[model samples]
Target: MYRTILVPLDGSGNANKALDIAAHLARANHARLYLLHVPVITEKNDDSLVTSPSQNDAAMQLIQTALETIDVSDLDTSILVRKGTPAEVIEREAHRLDADAIIMGYKGLGRTSNEKGGSVSAAVNHRAACRVVTVR
Candidate 1:
């Protein structure tokens, strides 16, 4: 039985599908859902990572939109917008939150895979300590 479920959203249709599945799982198990959106940190001319309000806003908006599409009104849910590599942030957050399971899309926005030939979901699946459910 799951007590805490984490779903990483990227505003992609697949990610939204994963959210729906996660919500169902959460409801069935009486679990809490943690929705996470990670905004990529851009590098400036000086090679310094920069985060702007707009970036954060976009992440929040993505989460909000996903929430609006899902029927999780009766479920306990938490939203988080963090700036970092999507895979790393999701992995760390799962550990930090002590999540029992993670449900996410198999592929997200942009490139299908990373430089290592694995997508963000793949990386999280390989590194996470808890159960990983990848929704196609």
Candidate 2:
């Protein structure tokens, strides 16, 4: 029933798995796929610096990389890159895109949850405006 699916990636294996799932779903349902990658931003000393590239620059590169990595030849796909907390950014973008569902990876770096879904996935499942499918 999903017309537009949002898939958040972090360049991790788990995220790639989610991408594959989203791609298949999009192909099956003839839906549009929105790929999002939230850059890893970290504070240095007292200044809040994006550990990744500058916002605009990093976003462009992230979108390019995401497109290159995903197999979207059979489905319509768009890329979005935003800077912020992963869960917050994903939720905001999903709403902004008016997506019908969000498909994302489960585990993340430094995650401690014994459950299949990681912190970000859990957060998105709780806060997103649409249905959240956390691929493990």
Candidate 3:
């Protein structure tokens, strides 16, 4: 029933778990997958800036690793790097892409590696225009 699926990832194992599920669903329904990574804004000594993948290896690796970890080789997949609050960007991309569904990790790397953004997923689940699947 899904034609286009958006999968937002945080480069965490839990996110990859969602990717695995999304990939399987894409294969079954012949759907296209859009992978999105939203980098949290970071601050330097005197300035604050949203990270760009071109300037941040961590952001680039997040995209690369997400691709490497998922088995979407046979499906149409596009990788997107966005800078904003994770929930907002994901919801925007979902609307812009006209996604039929969003599959994401139930928890992801929040402010740090030790915490999770249960709040972010909850927000997306409530706000997204499409169905949202939160994988644990």
Candidate 4:
């Protein structure tokens, strides 16, 4: 029943798996697909991390490579790159695009990952206006 499907990617294997699922679903339903990459931004002087520009470029390149590796001839696809918290950006884009659903990969962060309280998937699941599918 989905017309427009949004798949958020982070250049991870998990996200690539989700992309495959979303692509298959899109083809079956004759739906359009939107690929999104949310660039992770770190604070200034966070020497432990690279700058946002470099990170964004790297993430975009990875996304491009991933898309190239997919057989997307059957589905219409669009690419989006944004800067912000992953969950917030994903939710906003999903709403803005009027997508029927959001398909994303779950990192399967266990207790250790969620010890900080809320995970990105949790936040997006709670805040998204459309249906959210997490492919683990």
Highest-TM-score candidate = 1
The TM-score, computed over Cα atoms with residue i paired to residue i, of candidate 1 is: 0.91
Cand. 2 TM to true fold = 0.78
Candidate closer to the true structure by TM-score (higher is better), 2 or 3: 3
Question: Could you tell me the lDDT of residue 76 within candidate 4?
Answer: 93
Query: Which residue ranges in model 3 land beyond 4 Å of their true spot?
Result: 44-49, 52-56, 112-118
Residue-wise C-alpha lDDT for candidate 4, range 24-111, written one tens digit per residue: 9998899999999876656746444344777777877978888887777678999898866677788999999999999887873223
Give each model's whole-structure lDDT: 0.88, 0.78, 0.83, 0.80
Candidate 2 worst ten-residue window by lDDT: 109-118
Task: Report the error of model 3 at residue 129, Å.
Answer: 1.1
Query: What residue runs in model 4 are displaced by over 4 Å at the alpha carbon?
Result: 43-53, 108-116
Ranking by lDDT: 1, 3, 4, 2
Clashes of 2: 0
* TM-score, per-candidate, Cα-based: 0.91, 0.78, 0.85, 0.82
Instruction: Give the per-residue lDDT digits (tens) of candidate 1, residues 1-136.
Output: 9999999999999999999999999999999999998877765646655678898888888898988889898999999887667888899999999999999988888564545988888889899999999988
The residue-by-residue lDDT of candidate 2 on 42-135, one tens digit each, is 5664565455457567666755676687769778887776766777788899999999999987875434232345588898888888999888
User: Model 1: residues >4 Å from true position, as ranges?
Assistant: 44-48, 112-115
Model 3: per-residue Cα lDDT over 22-85, one tens digit each? 9999999999999888777665434544565453667768878777766688999998878767
Flag regions of model 2 displaced more than 4 Å. 44-69, 110-118
